[model samples]
Target chain A: MIQAALTFAVTCFALALVFNLWHLARAPGVVDRILALDTMVINAIALLNLYGISQGTPVYFEVSMLIAMVGFVSTVAYCRFILRGNIIE
Target chain B: MLEDTTLIAEIVVSVLLVVAGVFGLVGSLGLVKLDDTMRRLHAPTKATTLGIGGVLIASMIYSAVFLDRLSFHELLITVFLFLTAPITANFIAKSYMHRHVDEGDLPPTEGPYGWAVYDAVPEDERPIDTK
Candidate 1:
């Protein structure tokens, strides 16, 4: 039961990601692409946790946490660059 | 003794997860079709928040049923996601406005935002000026 549920979630999120990338391609501005990318990461993380539990492994949780942290940092960096034209001095 | 009850709980949670996935799909679709960056921002926020929110509720249910306890790790991630995505969106929008709009290009930002005030200062001094 868990496996089936996890599979469904994973499949859905994967499809969403593919669509998101396609959207990014269509989006002309960097901001639109970045926003889409952020949403992609979030979807992936949620799916990651579901996959983790289904497989009976705790490691995926750690990976999900790390992804969340790294993703957030990168988004912030991108924001700085977009705003100031430089991420760092 | 409680087997039937657990099955009932599982059914309810699984339905929620499925619903969440559907919401996410719709949001992704919106991202592709929207005409502008500002409009596109709304799609993901709605999906990532409400859609992902449903998934987390499902997670809480599964953990509670299988592991015999409330699993809060999902909650933490959900909370973190909700908090960060919006801030990122705001920063990205600000950056977009700063870069694309140009100094003279923007209408004067008055009222509580004070964006115009911040935009007026040189980058190095703007941070300190806020204090």
Candidate 2:
């Protein structure tokens, strides 16, 4: 049952990827693109979690954590740069 | 042979995975299908984070039932996500408003100082046409 669910989850992730990519490719503004990228990272985290369960391994959980950190920091940095016209400022 | 308890665990994991996937997909679809930036901003921060939460719960269940050890580490992802999703949403909203959102769309600033985004500049620095 769990295996079946994992397969479904993978399919859903593929659909989500397509959506994220579509948004990324045609985003009306830089901020929209950044939003799409952020969503993509979240989707990637879900995929990694599913993969971890399918393989019965715990190691991927750490990978998911790192991705979350990167996604959050990058989003904030991108927004900061756009807002202030300089990231470090 | 799967014990009844094991079967129940599998059921729970299955549900979590499906729910996570659906919500994640909906969130991404919102990103693509929404008409504008602010509307698009609403999608992933809320729905996608919840989706990931479901997946993390599934992972926790898998680790506990199959790996035979209780693991709280998966909860770290949940906690981190909850903490940061709103922060990202706020930053993105501010960036958009600061960059291109119409001044009319912006709410009245609550204080004598203009909006937070405008405070960095002296009131004299703003173009007379901006407000």
Candidate 3:
């Protein structure tokens, strides 16, 4: 059961990553592209967590947490740049 | 008895994983399909946050039941995600508004000052009219 669930989840997130890439490639606006990228980061985190569960290890937990922090900071920096024309005041 | 307990744990973890994946797919789908920028922003923030939360919860359970060591590390990721997702969304929305939305299109703030993104006055220099 766990193996089947892992396969199903991996497939779903892989599809999601594809969708995010599609959106990123042809996004109508810069904000749309940024949003797509942000979603991709989130999907990647989910993928990492699922892989950790399947492998029965806790190592990926720290990796995913780091990715989450970096992703959030990058997204915020991108937004700040767009808002103020620079990332830092 | 031990086999039954392990089987139940597997079932619980499997359900959680499946549900999380579905949420993740739907959130990405919404990101692609939603027509408006603001509307598009709505999809990933709420749905993917929950999706990741579910996965983390499942990971915690799996580690406890299968690996035989209780893990609290996933909780930190979950909490960090919940705290940051909203702030990230807000910044994104602010940036989108800065780029696409006009001051005229927004309803006036009840406060005397304009929206923070657009307000030009320094903190102490603005007028203090009450009404």
Candidate with top DockQ is 3
Give a tens-digit lDDT track for model 1, residues A1-89. 65576677777878888998887687787887788778888888878877766765556767887898888999889888766678886
Deviation in angstroms for B123 in model 3?
2.3
Count clashing pairs, candidate 3: 0
In terms of docking quality, model 3 is high
State iRMS for model 3: 0.7
DockQ per candidate: 0.64, 0.88, 0.91
Error of 3 at B53 (Å): 0.7
**lDDT tens digits, residue span B71-129, model 3:** 89999999999999899899989988899999999999897678988987666766795
Query: How should the candidates be ordered by DockQ, best one leading?
Result: 3, 2, 1
Structure candidate 2, residue pairs in collision: none
Top model number, TM-score: 3
* Poorest 10 consecutive residues by lDDT, candidate 2 chain A: A80-89
lDDT per residue (tens digit) for residues B27-105 in model 1 = 8888887787777788887776677878877877877787776767778877888888788878877867775766665
Tens digit per residue, CA lDDT, model 2, B70-111: 898789999999999999999988988887867777688875
* Candidate 3: TM-score, chain B only: 0.91
